[model samples]
Target: MTLYYDETGDTKLPFESLSIAETVIQGTLRYLESPYDAEVNLLLTMNNEIREINQEHRNIDKATDVLSFPAIDFEVPGDFSDVSTFDLNPETKELILGDIVISKEKVLSQGDEYGHSPLREYAFLIVHSVLHLVGYDHMEEDEKETMERIQKAIMEYLKISR
Candidate 1:
């Protein structure tokens, strides 16, 4: 799996953000039983940049902790049964999973607000965003419960705590 990460501005992450991102992504893929190698793009940005992206992409006009843009639209959430050859990257053959954009400012604040280390909160958000890349959503109760369960399992798999 390849995680393409780019950080904009200097929000100063509280931890080795790339390492944590890689570990959580790997754990998430394993927990979901995804057979194909994948590629995920991650962007770490500050409040102003995140707000612009949120407005441009989601029309929210506000900053958010994280935002996910999935490459594949699975017929069934977290099920790769429908993946086709065309979904693979031409050269590497890695599935184009999706992109995740996070606001570093929110990570620190949320961590303090929730009484956890910034590392834990950052890992949680990445896990949540990865779930979205794999077609998970929380718009409904059952979906929310299922996603929560999967997230908890992945967090445990990574041994990350809040």
Candidate 2:
């Protein structure tokens, strides 16, 4: 897996303690023993820029901790049973997963609220977004529970605990 990251935000604040944006591109190359080869891009932008994106895309004036844009449709493939395994890219050797957008301001605020470090919150957001990229959703109670369980497992695997 290849993870690509970009950050945009206020430089005045401590660089180590600011907002971040992470974009993950999954292809066929496996970095971890997971089913997908992924690339992650992280961007740290100012609160105003995040707010603009929120208003433009989500039409919500308030800032959010994370925003996810999934490239693939969630409808189970007809050959789902036949193809028990995921497909891989022959060229890139990856899965071409999707993208994830997050807000640093929200991370900081939520971290404080949850009594955890910002880094942990940020890792959680990334894990959550990656799960969404791979056809995970929490539209229902059961789905939410399942997704949360998966997220926790991934975080634990990565040693990112709260």
Model 2 lDDT tens row, 28-70: 1121235544444455566777778789988999777777765
lDDT of each: 0.92, 0.59
lDDT of 2 at 161: 71
lDDT agreement of model 1 with the native: 0.92
State every prediction's TM-score relative to the real structure: 0.97, 0.72
Per-residue alpha-carbon lDDT of candidate 1 for residues 1-162, written as tens digits (9 for 90 to 100)? 899999998679868999889888988888899998889999999999999999999899989999999999988998988999988999999999989999999999999999999999999999999999989999999999999998998899889877
Q: How many backbone clashes are present in model 1?
A: 0
Report how far off residue 39 is in candidate 2 (Å).
Answer: 3.2
Candidate 1 to truth, TM: 0.97
Model 1 misplacement above 4 A:
none
